[model samples]
Target: MSIEVRSLSKRYGRTWAVRNLSFEVQPGRVTGFLGPNGAGKSTTMRSIVGLDRPTSGEALIGGKRYAQQPAPLREVGTLLDAKSAHRSRRAVDHLRTVAATHGISRARIEEVIGITGLESVATRRAGAFSLGMAQRLGIAVALLGDPHTLILDEPVNGLDPEGVTWIRELLGSLAAEGRTVFLSSHLLAELALVAEQVVIIGRGELIADAPIAALTAETERVRVRTGQLEQLLRLLAADGVQATSLTPDTADIVGLPVDDMARRAAASGIVLLEIAPIHRTLEEAYSELTREAVEYRAGLTEQDAS
Candidate 1:
């Protein structure tokens, strides 16, 4: 199954939560959805699953709207909120109730409980569960229908390190099994580790939709260390290369290759200690993309001001 958002827009009175946003999430791969707070990520996701009706445009799953499907839960599983279940209900009863709504069997409910690692807490009331346990129960609910597409919003929130690793591996396995996995998470490093492609939105608009490798490849930097830093800087300046000094002997070079930097050093008689490429991480790339689009900017704290 594939997810397609075509010029989707949603409005609340005068404000547009999502505006003219469009993207396609292909099957058999994990696609990461990323944006800052109030960037309309949740709104777009709600529109996709028919939880929020779009003011304009459409969100499609397998070439049809979510509500158009006869068996919606069987086609798409969603974890929009971890605290969506009744607090007083036992974990097993919660999942069983959800399954019963879709005519799912108890065997399937147990299968998903095992899949989500919720067996130890299955009989425990949801109110007594910790945040991680609640997240597991939410995932168990989502998986109970054996859906073809899984949409998870902040799935890693409140998870422990072990639970984080488990979710990462589970998502990979699900994608390998030919299921479409679309997730939104603030943990950019974790998303980079699991997702092959990414869709970045900013201020209710589409900023970037590309493969993760391609986005990171555009901002490669090279770090170099040489004894004759001033001479190296002068030489690099002549070649129109941008460099920022990190230390007296080391500088980060942009718009130039490590091989060229080494060649320049050798010709200038500068003793080179280190010359290596600095791969741009996903966090850095995301920061650059959303810098101007961030809705809220934090100012200096009182201690810093003092």
Candidate 2:
């Protein structure tokens, strides 16, 4: 299954939450949905699941709107919020209820419980569960129907390290099975590891829709340390390589391959103590893309980032 968001726009009276956003999430891959706070990511996901009405355009799953599917759960599984389950209901009961509505069997419910690592807390009341447990239950609910497509928002909100690793593997395996997994997460490093492509939105507009590598390709940099700094600089300057000095003997070269630099410096008699490629992080790329579109720029304080 694939998710298609075509010019999807949603307005709340005088303000537009999402405007003219369009992107396609293909099957057989995990596509990340990323944006800053108040960037309309939640609104867009809700609209895709039919939880919010779009003022203009539409969102589709497998070429049909979410409401058009006769068995929606069987086609699309969503984890919009970890606290979506009934407060007083047992975790197992919550799964059973959702499963029952879709004619899902008891065996499948048990399977999902195991899949989400919720077996130990299955009988616990949801209201009494901790945040991490609730996140597991929410994921269990999403997996109960064995849906072809999953739409999750901040699925790792309160998970421990082990849980985080588990979910990463699960999502990767699901995508390998040709399922469409549209995930939104604030953890950029984790997303970079799991997602092959990303759809970035900013202030209700589409900023980027590309492979992770493509987005960060221009940010490729290489770090170098040479005892003969002047000799290395002259050689690099002769080659027209853009290098920014980081220290008296070290520099950061833009878009230079480590092997190429090492080979060139060796040929030029520039003894390099260290030569390594410093790949740009996804967070760095995202920061550059959304800088102009950010609604609020927070200033650091002694009480803030301490």
Local accuracy of candidate 2 as per-residue lDDT tens digits, 1-306? 789999999999888889999999999999999987778999999999999999999999999999999999899999988998889999999998999899999999999999988888899899998888998898888888899999999998899999899999999999999999999998999999899999999889999999999887774588899888878878778666888998999999875677887898899788899888887789999999999877756673222100
After superposing candidate 2, which stretches have Cα over 4 Å from the reference? 300-306
Q: Evaluate model 1: give its lDDT.
A: 0.90
RMSD of 1: 3.8
Write one digit per residue (lDDT tens) for candidate 1, span 1-306. 899999999999998899999999999999999988889999998899999999999999999999998888899999998988899999999988889889999999989988988888899999998888999998888788889999999999999999999999999999999999999999999999999999999889999999999888864588888788888889889878888999999889897777877887898798988888999898989999999888766772322000
Pull out the clashing pairs in model 2: none
- The TM-score measured for candidate 1 stands at 0.93
Candidate 1 residue runs with Cα over 4 Å from true position: 299-306
